[model samples]
Target: MPVRRFVPIAAVVLVASLAACNPSATKSESDSKPAASASAGTDRDEAGSSAAPGAPAGGNGLSLSEAIAKIPAADEVRDGYKRDSFKHWIDEDGDSCSTRNEVLLAEAGRAPEQGARCALTGGEWRSYYDEVTVTAAGKLDIDHMVPLAEAWDSGASKWDADRRMRYANDLGAERSLVAVTAKTNRSKADKDPSEWMPPAQSAKCTYLADWTATKLRWKLSADERERAALETLAEGCSGTAVKYEAAP
Candidate 1:
């Protein structure tokens, strides 16, 4: 496969023309389905200020402090786990675009030509995981912020199939699913924050915030070692914040 390339002038011009053709063609994170209702046994902090099951507290989501506090720590269980357990890439809204295509459309810096059946021809995107700029959609992977295996180990092993599906196909938050270079996504395969981090140093803060927020949103637990790693990383990310709606 070809390495990252500069955004071609023709692609830029094409995107601009598309924007002119349809003023509302641009997509945002909120365009996805409504927030899932909070579950009955939702966890909350001691202070009772975090019980509300809704979108992230702040417009940006949550501060590192808030996100860390929300995570429930527990021993992980990996029994009978399989990647196939979480069914993903569904066309949730009946649009031709699946979850993967929706992410590509939402994250693309320059819009691609949408052929029949939501086939994306050309676009530009920056893989924040490694700071690589890619033009071909084929070269990018829609990464689950918290990998499926990691989620199962953390707390998802106990969740029902429906909840797991919601977690996998989540598009309610911008930080949940990301478009990154295929290389970086594979390299990060199912590792927690303790085991791996983004290659781009500048992305570390945002990466941690997203990871933490995703865990809290889904009510997933972190093992002692993983929590320790996140706390240590949080120390360096001083004013950074995470924004995500709690996954129902």
Candidate 2:
């Protein structure tokens, strides 16, 4: 395997040839090249879309104003935080696929072969975070929009195991658990919007919306800095909207 390189963040046009809409598309070695940055000034509309009021609006839902209003602001607590506290990747549906595999299957642009024990092979995926297309299943990582550790600091530290598990394995919304290239996922490890944004500039609006919706759904608090960053990002995403149900 070759090491992947990170590109500087800049807006770039998306090649329609690699669009996620093509289920039969296969990734070539050239497809492994870094993606162009997302378009920053694009104006997408969600008018009359069936998505809930808090759900992602055209993948860029809810104006920054509306999304920020939903997040409860508070100081974070990090004392006694541990990664193992939350149980994840369970086969909640008893389909033999773990939560990780389930996300991969859901997000793949080109479907892969599923073998015994739900092993996946030969799928094509479009990683929205950095706009990278990958052919192998092993190259992707399912990322928690609001990372578990960040959640702990925000409020999950007080949650019971069951609640934490529900959050960890959430598959209810498309924005909850995202499948992205391992490089982008690792680059985002445990950071909030304040510390990181997707390398793809076009992804910023959707990323902010997803981050906000996840926090609102899980009732997670945002620290002052994180909230400020989200607010700033939202301002740039003019027509976007967000609709998320409160977490049970």
Candidate 3:
């Protein structure tokens, strides 16, 4: 298999490793999909990163995994899942910064080793979600894999704002709104997988696994068009090593 590449974005933002996107923005009713840069969709730059442990960054495009799609939809459990149930961005420790700040450290490659107040003093970001590479952490945004409003539409409206925030700021079990190129993040704002895809064509397989796992875990599903698109992508990943579920 060919190796995958990591392409940096236009105006680079320096970081310890992963970028630390500010978490103060309010949710928009319309732009639930990832944000798109003016350059249009994802910009696949031909750069590469040292392979992370999991699966090799090369494989087939999007595809469904029985394991990932197996979770039964818990529309009932999500009944009272308001945006306020899960308190987010709070100081996980008694430190000054919030959970979001901690994520910058955990995800970024350049973050400092130890600090009481956990500020992401050092790191650099390389967003795979969008082909555009981000050097400076602040320039990028920690995008929610599934937008709030969209989640609401999918059955999160009943959830308190706190619960919504937890999902938005989820860093556990690989669930999160990770840092990615602003353009790609915007383009993926609220739309489902059926609507758009990353500019990096090589990452289709990884993207599909992540998407499928998240949707399944959250008890969410794609609408008619969205489901069809996901199913189509899954067909391409039929015989690859891509995992549809995060390991225990």
**How many clashes in each candidate?**
3, 13, 61
Superposed Cα RMSD, model 2 = 9.7
Per-prediction TM-score: 0.76, 0.77, 0.61
lDDT per residue for candidate 3 within 46-109, as digits (tens), equals 1232112232123221224553445344332334444444456666445575655654554554
lDDT of 1 at 104: 82
All models, RMSD in angstroms:
12.1, 9.7, 12.6
How many pairs of residues collide in model 1? 3
lDDT by residue for model 1 over 117-230, one digit each (tens)?
999999888777777889999999999989999999988899899988988977654556788899999999999989999887756766776788778778899989999999
**lDDT, residue 196, model 2:** 92
**Ranking by lDDT, best first?**
2, 1, 3
lDDT of 2 by residue, 1-248 (tens): 11111111111111223343111223233222222211211111222223343334343344556768878989999999989898999987677888898777766677899999999999888887788788998989989988999999999999999999988987655557777899999999999999999898767766776787778778899888987888887777654445565555
Give the local distance difference test score of model 2.
0.67
TM-score comparison, 1 vs 3, better candidate: 1
Reference-based lDDT, each prediction:
0.66, 0.67, 0.47
Question: Could you give me the TM-score of model 1 versus the true structure?
Answer: 0.76
